[model samples]
Target: MIEFKNVVKKYDNNITATNNISVKIKPGEFVYVVGPSGAGKSTFIKMMYREEAPTSGSIIVNEYALENIKSREIPFLRRELGIVFQDFKLLPRLTVFENIAYALQVIEKTPEEVEQRVSRVLDLVGLSAKRDNFPAELSGGEQQRVAIARAIANEPSILIADEPTGNLDPETAEGIMEILEQVNKQGTTVVMATHNSFIVNEYKHRVLEINGGKIIRDEEEGVYSNEDANA
Candidate 1:
C-alpha cells in the first residue's frame, strides 16, 4: 500500500509542485489520476518512487518511508515498483526480449530466472510471436505492449504509468487499458496519470483530481470532467 501525509514539494524558485498532498492507495487497487497539465500529477507519482524528493511530509510506499530511506536503499525500493511512460522508452537497439531482460539483468537475476520471467510476461502481453522484434520493427500499439511487458517483467507490486495513452489511438489505448486492468486483477496496484477523459469515463476507478498542486476530489467510480478538476 501507498500512503502520503501532508506532503509538499517546492522547487528552488519557490514554486510548489505539490502542496500539502496526502492520499492512500491500497494494494491491488487500480486508480486514475486526472487533472490538467502541470497539476502536480507527475510530481505526485514520481515521489512514490523517490524520483523526486519531497521537501516536507511523509510518503510511505509498501512500508518504505521515502522521507528517510537512504540513497543506497532506493534501488531495493524500486524493485517493488514498475514504471512506464508516454513515450515507449524502449532501447531502440535491443530486441523486445532483450529490453525486458535488461531490467532483471541489472539486478543480477540468474539467467534462468530472467528467461522464465521474460517469457511469461511476453506471453501475458500477447507478444510472444514478436519477442525478437526491435522497437522500430513494431507498430505503435505493439511497441506499447512491449513497454508494458518490460515494466511488469519483474513482477512489481505497484505499476505507475504517466500518460500511457497519450500517443495511441482510442482503439489502441483501449487495448492498453485492458492489459492494465488484467494486470491489476492479478494483484498489482496500478496508478495511472492521464488526460484522456473518454478513457476515464469508460473505465470507472478510484479517481483523484488534482489542480494547482492540491487534490480537490477523491471519488470511487469517478468520471472525468473539468467541473471539479480545472479548479
Candidate 2:
C-alpha cells in the first residue's frame, strides 16, 4: 500500500510541484494519475519510488517511510516495487533475457533463481521467443515489454508505470495495457500516470485527476475527456 499525507514538494527555484497532496492507494487496486503536462503527475509518481523527496510530509510505501528512508535502504525498498518508464530503459547490449535477469542478479539471486524468474516474466510479457534478441533488434513495443518484464521479474508487490505507453502506437499501447492488466489480475497493485483518455475510458479504474499540483477529483471507474481534464 501507498500513503502520502500533507506532502509538499518544492524546488530551489520557488516552484511547488506537489502541494499538500494526501492520498491512499490500497493493495490490489489499479489507480490512474491523469492530468495535463506539468500538473505534478511525474513528480508525484517519482516520489513514490524515492526518485524525489518531499520538502515536508510523510510518504509510506510498503512500510518504508520514503521521506526518511536512508540512501542504502532505498535499494531494499525498491526491491518491493516495480517501476516502468515511458522510455524503455533497457541495456542495449544485453539480450532480452539478460536484461530481465540483470535486476535479479544485482540482488544476488541464485543463477537458477534468476533464470526461472526471468523466464516466467518474459513469458508473462509474451516475449519468451525474443529472449535472445537485443534491445536494438526489437520493436518499440517489444522493448517496452522487455522493460516491463525486467521491472516485474522479481515479483514486486506494487507496479508503478509512468507514461508507459507514451511512445507506442495505439495498437501497441493496447497490447501493453493487456499485459499490465494481466499483471494486476495476479494481485499486483498498479499505479499508472497516463494521458491517453481512450485507454482511461476503455479500461476504467480509480482516477486521481490532478491539476495545478492538487488533486481535483478522485473517482472510482472514472472516465476522462480532454474537456473534463482541462475543466
Best by TM-score: 2
In model 2, which regions exceed 4 Å deviation? 229-231
Stretches of model 1 off by over 4 angstroms after superposition: 226-231
Give every collision pair in model 1: none
What TM-score, over all chains together, does every model reach?
Answer: 0.97, 0.98
Candidate 1 residue-wise lDDT at 185? 93
lDDT of 1 by residue, 1-231 (tens): 999999999999898999999899999999999998888999998998999999999999989999999999999999989999889899999999999999999989999999999999999989999999899999999999988998999899999999899999999999999999999999999999988888889988999999999998999988997554555
Q: Please, what is the whole-model Cα lDDT of each candidate in the order they appear?
A: 0.93, 0.94
Measured on C-alpha atoms, candidate 1 has an lDDT of: 0.93
lDDT of 2 by residue, 1-231 (tens): 899999999999999999999999999999999999889999999999999999999999999999999999999999999999999889898999999999999999999999999989988888989999999999999999999999999999999999999999999999999999999999999999999999999998999988889998999999899886666
Cα deviation of 4, candidate 1, in Å: 0.4
